[model samples]
Target: MSSLTMMPMSLEEIAQAVQGRLVAGTAAANTPVATSAFTDSRQIVEGSVFIAIAGERVDGHDYVPHVGAQGAVAAIVDHEIADADVPQIVVEDTVLALGLLAKHNIERRRALGTPFTVVGITGSVGKTTTKDLMKALLSHMGSTVAPVGSFNNEIGLPLTSLKVNAETRFLVAEMGANHVGEIANLTSLVPPDIAVVLKVGVAHLGEFGSAERIAQAKSEIIHGLVPGGLSVLNANDEHVAAMSAFAPGDVMWFGLPNGDGGNPAITAQHVRCDELDHPSFTLKNGDGEHAEVTLGICGQHNVMNALAAASVAMRLGMSIDEVASALSDVTTISPHRMAVSTVNKQETSFTLIDDSFNANPDSMKAGLDGLLRWKAGSESQPFRIAVLGTMLELGPDEKDLHVGIGRYALEGGVDALLTVGSASDASLDALAGAMADGASLAGDASHVDWVHDIDEADRLVTRLAVEHPGAVVLLKGSHASGLSALAERWQALAAQ
Candidate 1:
């Protein structure tokens, strides 16, 4: 974790510029960057370039003492410093400087005409899952470098970029944005040769203020595309389809329905899944050839992730069969999302859907749709319930977004509901009030249940599972909801 190890090139080419400036420490051409470089002090290592920026919760500059003490080679700060002992690189903005340094670091690598190829992906949801799938596919083809998990932000993007070099074959990066500045900054750093917009929704409608603003922010991935680069999109996602007008290069799209009529650059046909709704299907292109793929994991939403990954693979010259074969067997990483969960003990098996990583209105509905379909298929399924928590960090549109999710639950066939937190109460109340009005709802209203907290909800889930014997339960919330703890409880019960 030594910052030096991550910035081998940056340190050597400093030319004493890094002593007080963000210049190369050495004269060697194409300097070797360290193992990995990062600006977040929370994930710091020796020789790391500590870019101190003022975030919403805390200012990294105040933590400069800790980062400097941790062996950071230099501190990139927005303020002019008087710390003579600290190698401080003064910049107008730490975030902006990180982007510049990262681009400079990559420019040296790109100059050699090496095998490196950058793949950038952006969307409202599924960015991480898509990145993971893309990495899995590309690694099978060559030496691949991808952002670790959800490290798709300003600091994370550049750190992921520095890992790419002359020998690297595929460089995959996940581009995420909260404000307009973030996407533009991250995009300029990697300058991807290809880009993918998985899909877009109202996930961050609060921050960007509107879905249109969110779409514009998500579309920034195309800004840094290498000339003549390819843009792969999810045609089913309205926000993504709008991107076709903004892309500067070739555009291709994938969809569940081929009716978009431009023959859907690629279409997943005869899609089928297990009772869990994990999809497996044949991907057909213009040639009418079919490649069968069985997604190891279950979830219709994830199937869309796979198809999004496949479209990029196709653009990379992978045969349809090769794409299918590559995705068919590889393990789909967890916490990305899925349809349902089954907790089986020595006697009884319980069904649960965990879409808890993070939720927005659209993904919430998708999760409900998948869970309800599973519940309906199993007629004897005891109780169909939704255990929901809050979706945080959503500035203003939180209430509306949460309400939209609740409406989907009522409409998507959730039999009973359990909500947590006041933010979540806003959603659950809407469902209850709407159902009270006798509006046509998903399932029996007599089964409706609401909990004020996780403990209360847990008690209900355990009781319902034990009594009903066969039920499909869904637990979804933001990162702070502690829904995973509930899943852990279910897992423990199943183990017993």
Candidate 2:
């Protein structure tokens, strides 16, 4: 919030951008607007503009007087609030008004003729990690701003864009969708200079209905690029690579060599993991360019993420060595995605891989693979334990997907699999049990156990770790299953 300088917009420009008429207060059109915009009154600082949004559970209009008392200069509302003290701009829909304001702000920045650029990213997984990596790498070049967390939706996108100003050099936007046209709508707010499509997977199969629909949703990012902008894609994903033709500009691909006679623009070769699963590989760019790079994060899956970010950095005039050094400096920015921690209790000591932010078929397998590969090369041959929870939004074939993940664990050489979720929630409990059942079918039944709750799973994992010293345990699941909470519990106990 306090990094770069933010220019305030005039009230007249806000009215013209949203086509709203200021119907109240004695404020003149030339008056300076607020410092920032917000829909939640609790975030309203001095000189903030309150945009009233009526959501499913609460209405922002109800907080008008509260924010005004807290020093809000004006309010953008859909209806006239009785006896509202501050100036009010009435629009048809406040959400659309917010987008219009962001679009105008972007255009205004473009009109300044500065070296501002917008890079948009969209994918089923790895979007957040890639965004964090790009932000860290790009920061070494110029001023960069991105969303706080998973702020990739309609409301989140515009809020991030509102922070852009004259001195802003690069803006990294994360676009996400649950349906076909969601990304398209977000792209309209701020057209991108460089579009990155990570992968087209079934993360939201329930809402999208099919992987094909999900692919279409992901391609919207490419379609929304500005004229002659570049496209960075994952060559390993056929659905993603095929999107190149749809882009309005040239494309750059990143992935490991497929050995099908296709050389990606950026590639990682001779990939190796250390004792803690940190990957080191030779980075190869187009035109016989190569650099020996090492990553601080612990995941084979993240190698693809590194390639995507490095491709962007290279295209933006950064040398391969600089990109490698920047990437190597980053261990893990965002939490709960392959986040590694060492637990050194008196009774038990092991490493914990906390990937408990969210889960799907693709990410669950990726995390499990990382857990297996981490211990594969170690002399200790640590017992690799995967404590998995429910993967939500997998559609009607959820049972099959869970079973397949279980089989993946067994085939990937996981020594023990512990499944946990809500017991009272019959659907999730059954899903976790189904995962354990599938793993039991592949290996010894005693190695796979499904607990109906987190407490039992926590006790089981602690007991297992004490039983097998120096073991590596992984916690992977959606946020609802409380696997992240269990990880936090272990972290706090370790701190003590």
Candidate 3:
């Protein structure tokens, strides 16, 4: 559980930056502070500053003494702990103090007058993938710091932005939100010199109410950009494309050109996927410059992600060829997002497409499409098994959305469909029942089955692997669905 190593700041400097009073302990002001910051007591490395975050399930304040015992240099907490011998920086709000400390760190880096660039990316989907791509491309130019995973919220963004130092030249911040103004608040802390909005989807419909609200929420990144900053937008999405009107600075477009001569600054042409659904395309810029890029990853949706990253890199003075080379070399950095790996059971093996990290309507369709395309071009006919789990966060239309995906799977010609989880609370409106019913009614009942939970799904998955040799199994759903754990189980079984 070791966190990333960070530059050390003195105890006095940290307390001053957060505007907190060092109320306790006898540590010297000049002590080269903690090596890094920690929120969880168990993750505390020697000489780390622990920030006590208050949560409903667990109060981090209760763990102050625990982290202090683990050699923490200081603790930032809302309440003063009398028994704790460690230096305590008492603040009114620990969360706000964390953000203030992060902003102070960024300001210190800027005062050094170094060549630092911050690229902020926000979207309903593909934010992490695009962030990974941006990091790959930007890493070629200079020292870069992006989020560890989906660390794009208030707490995560500050933790990421605080990583920037004198040597860091590029910072890629992935911004995500469940409601309005969350991105705006994040942007206030780490405003971007460049902003990339991939797409606005219904990923958090339950929280935001409507797609328009989501679009509105995504546009906040544009408004929060630094003066004269650049915007990299997806021209294919109407909601994303519409964001260009709000851009105070210049804007660059990426995606497939409509060929009505609506040439974007960066685009993909001659796009095609291999039998394994790995995409290859010609990277074209507005000046008619183009280079053939063969991606090392699977999924056609990644083409748009690559284009977004390419646009950002090119804006920062990377040539078209350099962008293409860097992009083609990037395999899947994040796990379970179109990650293609093989699992062998005795004499036979199957290709496992683990897009089970998280899911929504848009991502679910993308995973299914990729799964279908992977099957289409294979020389050996492989049975496509889609073990779909519940897609959480859809408001009222969850049932219809789940049912639609089920129908889409049947129409996509998937063989042996399996849905996990129980029926909805009333009228069996649960996502599993809706999906299973859609498949059963669309095709033969024998081809579709519903399992009660992830354990049953795992057992069924093992059985399927044995029965159908060379089958391609796709695992897709939200984190709540637990398909990601199932995917890991399958991978471990294969390794055996």
Candidate 4:
């Protein structure tokens, strides 16, 4: 919530530049721009533009009165709303207007001669992390702007485009998908000469309905790339591997241990992951160019994130040494997307792995992997745990996707499992059954640990901390479920 010394322009002036209209204003042409923007009415600030949008269940026109009170200088309505005189810049369609405005702004910015390098990234997993890596690597070389948080969706993507201007040298745009064609729409608004598609997984299965559909939805970014653009993909992910033929130009791949299924690119070795699995490794290309780089963040999965960013940077002419050196000063973002926070309600008694910021199958797996790494070689005797919440937005196939995470966590070495939320209830049962069956196979049936709620397990976690003295715990869930509250309470008990 910090303020920038940026000027504001009225909605009327923006309409004139874009060939839009002033529908109901006696002050149409007279209205000067206080600020330029493209968003629903709710985001309208003082002297700003309100893009009256229509989507899903609600129409933005329904909120024009509220926007006016919020100080929007003029309202841009597509179809007529029941308004008299708030100075409307009417358009054909507000959603399309949002993209066109963004597209237009990008063009104007480009004409300034120092067009920012637009690194467009989209996939099921690691888009945010990869975007963060790319942002860090680019900032090492020049001024960079990346989206703040999951600002990669419909509203977020257009909003991110507004941040691009004459001052921005690099803009790391993260694209996300839910249904088919979503990525394509966003990519067209800000085409990239260098596109990155990270790992694809069962992310929005609720919307896409199947993993194959999910993969197809993710592939939209490849097709939308600017001609002769480079495509950077995860060589390890089968979905990314399939995209080699679709890329318009050269395809560069990066992965762990360097798997060559007849195509060779770059590889990373001598990896040293911290308790969080944040990586510092030596990166060597098919050529002899080599350097040791460590991530500003941590995670076993983040190794790939760093590699993806490094690959794009190196191709764009950044030296390995510069990328490696700048990484040391970069920092990971928060809300337990593998963040280690100091905002403890308790003593610094336990580390909280908050994957609650966003969750899908792969992110859950990566978070669990980080937890295992943290628990490894620790002096804590009570063992590590996984607290899970429902991965919302996975429509009908939710049960199956939830089971996939449950199985991965059990196999990955989380000693105890704690599940919350109604969507994950079935996941809890399946995990208990899987653990029981595995225990039975080992000839021991009494050791499976499953808690019905976070409260029930809080005391046990406290005892684990007291007994072992240095217990590490993981708390992960979707943002909607407020799982961090449990993490805070658990940390409080451990502290006392």
Q: Per-residue lDDT for 1-496 in model 3, tens only?
A: 1225455688888899899998656644456466677677887777878899998899888888767679888899998987775788999999999888888777777778879899999999999999999999999998899998788888899888877777888999999999899999888888899999999988999999999999999999999999989999998899999999989899999889787977777889899998889899999998889999999888999999999999999988899999989888998778889888888765567889999989998898999999889758557778888989888878999898888888889887888788887433333326788989888777767768788777887667667867888788899988877788888987796677
lDDT of 2 at 117: 85
Model 1 stretches with alpha carbons more than 4 Å out:
1-7, 10-35, 40-92, 334-336, 339-349, 375-379, 391-404, 423-443, 480-496
lDDT of 1 at 360: 69
Residues 1-496, candidate 2: write the lDDT tens digits: 4432234776666877888987656754356466677778888777777889999999999888667778787889999888776778889999999888888878888999989889999999999999999999899999898988778999989888877877788999999998889999998999999999999888989888898889999999888999888999999999998898878989999999999898798999999887677889999899688888889888878899899999998999899989989999998678788888888776788888989989999999989988988857656698899999999888999999999999899878898899996878999999998999889888777889999888998778888898888888999998888898888888886677
Question: lDDT tens digits, residues 158-251, model 4?
Answer: 7777766667777788898867988888888888878888887877777877778988888888888888888998888898889988899999
Candidate 3: regions farther than 4 A off: 1-8, 66-71, 346-348, 422-429
Model 4, CA-based lDDT: 0.69
Compare candidates 2 and 3 on lDDT and give the better one.
2
Of the two candidates 1 and 4, the one with more favorable TM-score, higher being better, is 4
Cα RMSD for candidates in order: 4.6, 2.1, 2.4, 4.2
Error of 4 at 19 (Å): 7.3
lDDT of 1 by residue, 301-416 (tens): 77778888887777677888888888877665645366345787544567766777777666767777777767355546556778776666565756655656665677666667
Work out candidate 2's RMSD over C-alphas. 2.1
Order of candidate numbers by lDDT, starting with the best: 2, 3, 1, 4
Off by over 4 Å in 2: 1-7, 28-30, 56-58, 83-85, 344-349, 494-496
Per-residue lDDT, model 4, residue 35, is: 49
